[model samples]
Target: MSALRSRKIKYFFILPSIIWVLAFTIFPLFYSLGLSFFKVRLGKPTHFVGLANFERIINDYKLVNSLKVTLLYVAITVTVQIVLGILLALLFHQETKGKSILRALMILPIFCTPVAVGYLGLTIFYEEGGPLNSFLMSLFGAKIPWLSHPTWAWVAVLLLDIWQWTPFCFLVILAGLQSLSEEIYDAAYIDSSSEWEIFRKIALPMIQPVVIIVLLLRLIESFKIFDVIFSLTGGGPGTATEVFSLYTYRTGLRFFDFGYASALSYLLLAIVMIIINLFFKRIRAVYE
Candidate 1:
């Protein structure tokens, strides 16, 4: 085919993706931004009220609480995932029997859809006769509320998050570790470097980029976490586990306040952008 024709063919193939992004991504972004300036309610005319929705955010106690819990959740889950993930990656990196099988089992959770995992959590954490509760009963004869109460509800959410995402961190971090040459470790050993010393000095610095990437990915996902919480707890027994996304969803859909919901979602976007910016700045500073 001629160059022009070949290029035209490629464009033809790419056209659907371009349209999809425009329709779903770009349009909704600008649309939401515009919507945030309006006072939209069900069965009422939409009227622009400049900065009202954003201003209201300052006094919205529920919104503030949601952000707080969400941040706490992300902080705990991401930290645990990173710390435990690194340990598991290191364990799996060493030669051992049945480790391949253990790695396979660990990563299986990552392959499961968040919704499916949520439902699975529902079963496992059932307070009555559930596997976890039943095991607890057998051992201690007490039923712990897995989906009720603020503290336990938070625990449930964080636990499921840790269970699902830690494997992903392990897999990526392990890949980064495996890329290092054996000669590096042999040299370290020749230098009389202890195992912890090698990890703290050589392995960590080498994998810093990988760890940052994983942190960014997890932060983005955890901030927007909805599927698992929705399927598992539905924002819980009394909104105790409601995160930003869940609150925005309720405001827009359940309460039919699209203006405030749009504003809330935009705020979430801003928070995520800030986080990503800081990470990128750190990454650049490191290289510089």
Candidate 2:
């Protein structure tokens, strides 16, 4: 076949993907962008409102509260997941019996859907006559309310997210760890007497780029956290766990404020874009 024909064949193969993206992704994105600039309601005629919807964000106290909640969740979840994941990855990278079985079990949580995990968490964190409280009650003779209190509700959501996502970080970090050259470690061992020194000087540097990638992915995922919180806490205990995404959802579907909801969603998109760009710039600076 001619080069042009081969190129055409490649494009033909990718045509479906292009069409799918345009239909599902690009179309809805622009549609929502248009919707964000209008006043959309169930029974009312739609009209352009310019920046009216966006302007409400400044005075919206609930929006600020939701943002604070989301930032808190994101900060804690990402930090704990990264630290615990690194430790677990290091532990499993050792030459130990049952390592395969242990690693398999560790990654099992990541395979389960977030909704299912949330439901499972309900069982584990039951306030009255629940397993966790039961155990704590046995130890301290007091049951700490997991779902009923505001602070504990946030804690419950954080725990669920950390439980599910830490393994993902572990998997990625383990892969990066395993990709290192054995010779490099051997040379480092000869030069350094302490294991921490060797790991700090050689192993960590080798896997840092991978860790950065995992951090970026986790940050984005944490910022968009919805499903787990929806099934687990329903963003309740009086809005203690209501992240920004959940609030935006309530604004659109519950309150029937599509224009404002769309504006909130676009704000979230802009925040994510800004975060991603910062990370990208940092990565570029490192490489350049």
Candidate number with greatest lDDT? 1
lDDT of 1 by residue, 58-146 (tens): 99999988999899999999999999999989988999899878878887989789988889899999888999999999999898988
Lowest summed lDDT across 10 adjacent residues in model 2 is found at 1-10
* lDDT of prediction 1: 0.90
C-alpha lDDT score of every prediction, in listed order: 0.90, 0.89
In model 2, residue pairs whose N, Cα or C atoms come closer than 3 Å (at least 3 residues apart or on different chains), thus clashing, are none
The prediction achieving the highest TM-score against the true structure is: 2
What is the per-residue lDDT of model 2 for residues 32-150, given as tens digits with 9 covering 90 to 100?
88888889888242899999999999999989999999988899999999999888888888788998788889879888988888898899999888899999999999988899899
List where candidate 2 sits over 4 angstroms from the true fold. Answer: 1-6, 43-45, 281-288
